[model samples]
Target: MKLLNVSAGKIQTVEIGGEKVRTAHVKMPRPEPWIITPDGAEGDERASHPDKLYAFARTGYGHWQAQLGVAPGEWNDGFFGENLTFDGLDETDIRVGDEFMLGEDVRLFVSGARTPCIKLAWRLNQPRDFLKTFAASRHTGVYLGVLDPGTVKPGDRLERVVHDPGMPSIADVCDYVAGVQAPVELMRRLLAFERLSPTLRILLGARLNAAEAAERAGRHHWTGWRDFRIGRIVEETPEIRSVSLSPLDEGPLCLPQPGQFVSVRMADPSGDMIQRVWSLSSYAAGMDSYRLSIRRQQGPGSNWIHRAQAGDTVQLKAPAGSFVLDPGSYHPVVLVAAGIGITPLMAMLEAHLARENAPAPVHLIYGARRPGDAAFLGELLALAAARDDFTLTQVYSQADAGDWPRSRITAGIVKESVRDTYIALDGRRIPVPWYESDIYLCGPGDFCDALRDELVELGGQPGHIFSERFEAAGMAPGEIEEAEVRFVRSGTAAHWSARSGETLLDLAERAGVAVSSDCRAGACLTCRTPVTGGKVTADLGDGSALLCIGRPATPIIELDC
Candidate 1:
């Protein structure tokens, strides 16, 4: 490929969305040869994009000029803000990690595709939808990293010195970023690129996670939902109830990984379908049925569950969650729980006891309001009585005189237990220290947070501590205000509030509106929706918003869905 021009730009002020911002998106051809360095070409402003050293590509200027009806002499070389405008370098022809020698002096590696954003639209004086058009064109150009920097002048020949066919092409990377589904194997290959750009690596990783998730969803035992008969209901406590269920079709049930939960879908009193997740409380090793422990909370889902009886059927999805025990680790286990949080820990403890191999020593620190408030108290005590390696400490905040431990669980109590507890190993008893154990915490948000901080302060490794809470992790706090959200295509509307702490995607699910979403944290723009009216707090460059993280910032919001 021959370099047509060498362009560099100074930072300039531009207006976007009624705000003046400094950008370096405009470039002019230099009169003489430019000195290249490890950072970038000399005299070029690159602070706005530090992840990449330079942008270089053949911008298809003639094609776009004709398509957009630009007059002659307009849309010149380097008009797309590329530093080195090339004559014949196509995005589809080059792969990441491809090395090229320019004029036999400067060496650079193709990093990844230059992702188009709103700045591209502003620089071209086009509408916001131009971002999508540019991306769909798959001619977004390539970003480069300097390898052996030297002098490079206009009309310099760019000779390809290296090419790896196994690596993803620049066009492939652009397609992946443009919401096109890539095969799992291709994504894996992209992730394995040794010299891949950091920004592309992160994006590929999130896409790989989302792709694998979709594959797992397709591999689920049942699609949509399946009916499960309620075998029995046992009142573990006045507030907690355990229901055993088996598939009505008599098909084998996929055993849940210890600490995993399943979604139960049923109709409420109003005959509206609703779904709730409940942790599996039974040992999965030899289980013929699934047992879900539910607390009688003041909600439509819980109320319907409490009012249900045996012989009734409910729709169940396959078990899911990453909170399972580390079966491969031999580290001593510390299971801490409060209230209904004990359900998952109970599964872990029981699964450990049922293991054919020698299990790791476990210590359960359970807390409740009082002795009667603790579900599975008798069952846990029986297991502890039967095993010397398994230890149980019951902490009750309002325990009576007859209760064994009559105080709330604190860091002090945990420290004392860490010093006192012992594990039997090879006919010897060794003290189980906090730092050496893998601590699993589950409970209310505040309880888990406080305990996690205290444990970290007590010299416990933060990575050794894993936690699960009642709400979604990484949820951000926002002002509580009621708002109306309308999904135009679905013809559905719902009342929303920061008080519910639900994203628009979550609201769409509850409102029975189907919205395509993957990686529901806004990393992938699969859930991006057009905002026809009203307002939302988002980070989109265009007039669209990502429903996964976008929250209503106005009293009424309308989405094209």
Candidate 2:
């Protein structure tokens, strides 16, 4: 491998999304013989103290540019916050435990792949969708651990001193990090790699244990589809409505835990079936029906649901999601929501209140553009008034005249809410210490990310916070490249292009191909299928792609459909 460029920089403050954040080398320059250490380049800063030496690489930039139709010189070296840009090195060929001799004496060991964070998107001035795109691209560079810290410079020829044949490639490790389900043996092999970070090892071990437990439990996985009838429809707001559903067969409905979502399928104006997922907004231990509160958006699915009346029939699948309350924990809970995001959190709050024993105190901070846009406000207010364990803080971003304070939910507001000894709800001051609470965030992706970063800055444990997105956020239009998709099982092929603006599922359906799918948003993993050849970009990082949110990145994509 030939080192093309070496760069380093100290932490500097930059304004992003109207807030100042500390970032390193937004525009790093190639430096000659830069000092290298176990932590990182001498001047670089990262949260991980003495590990995760290298930040990023430029190996995949060429592929990204070709796929995205970006012009030359539109992006430069260090654009991805990477310290190293190399030539003639295949990123996929590098494996964990591979030792490289840098310059004459400096030795570096491959540790792991660089996990893309929100900051990288901010640095690139890309939209939020860029995060998923980068992960799907699988070119996120690699991290290195210094075995013999020394000076390394541009034009330094890198010689491989060692390679572990049993180890997985950085791409494989990245796939695992992106929520790909690995085989038990693969997990064990990764855990045994001595050069792997301790934190990563622990995570792999946990995943292995969980997979084993699930296998032993013999849990019956839900497949196929079921039918439901809308029992009631209530207008919650001018643009939002709550639909109550019941099984058509009069059988028992599947009980979903709080914060879980169910997939709903309906026909569009052209009679093409469209599938969308909505969170269960209310929870009753033995209820016979499920409630989904939906806000009308520009999409056809939401608009159709908004116009539907009671007694309308729809197809639905079982609830599937990992975003749920920790039943074993007794920690105080803080639920944060914006606009219609209050649905799932409401279910969680109700579940907590229904506990037989004394439950931990629950606080909710909800925001909306106006008082009229807030859904379930009356029910939430009544619940808070009736229970001492429940408290609510309402924030409106565009309220003209209101009794409540008008403010946007930000990191500052979250920190202030947590530090206060008592929470102010309406005119009542409820004594509650929220600093020690576990946080649950739901809303637009950008809003949730900002709140999460703030909470972490205020000493909140990253693991203690949970979040879910209402929809695939930041769907922006861009140039699309022409491609071909081949279905292995069906012995058929279809043409696709960026201008089609349709998911693989939609394309397949139009081409008379049958693929089982439920939630098309990449959350439920219902449309997951392996790509045997070529490349495809998706919203999620698993080895398989969600056809609902997947697009071709190469000239030809072969799917094991």
Candidate 3:
């Protein structure tokens, strides 16, 4: 695609995880070290190319090009001081070594994908444009690392070295998706492909797989969806629910591996929404539905679950977590729970209790606010009484108890209870169980951390400890007073007084500018700001990155945000 008539765009949008980010706005070329930034790029971002300047512009934490005025074509709502915003030439299909002679001598080649950081997903104005960008520059854009960097003018003849149409390529994968159906093995192939373009690697592939499964569910494991209200509302606590679901679907239920989890996908009453995940806690019981222990909360997409009715239908993805039972029983299972941590535990316990040699029973240690705060109290007591293999201990730190303690669970107590054999938290262990025996865990972050630390110090191997962290241990006021940065796009200069705990995404959010972000976890690759000037260290072994999660540390940092 060729673009003409481009000039300058003001920094119209900025944000962090949809929140406005605020910092002392300073001039460009902020300062040295440029390395100390809130983020860096993912995948092959650091691997620069000598072809596409657009690709290079998209690489840094924040990127900008020297605009020598404007040229050709009159489209673009957000200027962002851009260089080449074009049309035509099969944009997504461009590749490295493939050059296009643009206005003047400015040339570009497909170098890499512009994996996004949170900055792109942030909301703007009232938030209408947040989703619009899904199809904007972030979507229909590719990076061009400059080969022979030169001044590019508008309205220049843009010619390209077009290759034969018919050739085995990842680009073909995009066509498959746009046409009839995405190949069942498309995701697998993309995952297997080595060093593919950033665009194809992320969007045309990663983001497209599960999405394709939803769009076309032929033979895909996630195709068989089910979530029916089966039973009455057995009970309800202040923040959670105990629902008994009888499988409404009459077909035989598909049995999953013990630890595998199911994804609960639901949309809000408002049409604009996305999906979220949840776990199932009951063993598969034929066509009849089992129990799902859920904690209702006020978050992005959980309002519906809180207000769900007894007979309300909910769509469920197939079971898919990496924690579960193995072929052979290890030994002396040790299960622990903090709050709702018992979800997977219940399912696992049901299976283990049924097996003849379920790894010498379990040393179950559960922590709750009070003995009465336990959710599955009745079921738990029954398991202990009915089988000699199972032993139960409870910690009701806030309440008194019989045989149960009046203190929170401690490593000392747990260590004494099941120090001898392999332990299972809720369900049985899978993958590498107790050096083949099994050690499993799942719970809130803080609880999991405290318990895991003690166990590890007691000599737990890396793979030996399997666990999951749900919520933040807590969200504290950011140490905003410690961050320092520098912007390097147009000119060179520096800024100070930035806080350390602050993320570039958050800074944008506070500034009331709309940046993009989703799945704040580092994986999704949205919210990518180019590192035009300085560098920033990211938590993910990868270098500088999306400001949404990146914490600024270095004395000076640069980004395209």
Per-model C-alpha lDDT, please? 0.74, 0.73, 0.48
lDDT of 3 by residue, 446-550 (tens): 777787887766545444566766543222233334444544442333343443345666665655545565434332345666665444545332434766656
Ordered list by TM-score, greatest first: 2, 1, 3
Each candidate structure's TM-score, on Cα atoms with residue i matched to residue i, is: 0.50, 0.53, 0.44
RMSD for all candidates, in order, please. 16.5, 14.9, 23.4
Error of 3 at 327 (Å): 4.3
| Residue pairs in collision within model 1 | none
The CA lDDT at 156 in model 3 is 52
Cα lDDT tens digits, model 1, 1-561, are: 787777888888786544345678788877776777887777888525544454555547766777788875777656788887887668888888899998978999988877664467878888656766787676677888888989987788888899989887888778877768778898787768676665566456656655543453344256567899998899999999889999888887666678877778888667888767778898754456899889998777778778889998898877767787765444568899988899999988886676543324788889899889999999888988998778888888887423245777776666556554443333345343456577889898788889989887776767678887864333234453889999999888999977787888999999998887644544335678899888777636577888887888778889997
Q: Please say which candidate is ahead in lDDT: 2 or 3.
A: 2
Model 2: how far residue 263 lies from native, Å: 1.0
Q: Candidate 3, which segments miss by more than 4 Å at Cα?
A: 1-220, 224-231, 244-249, 285-287, 300-302, 419-437, 460-462, 472-561
Worst 10 residues of 3 by lDDT: 35-44
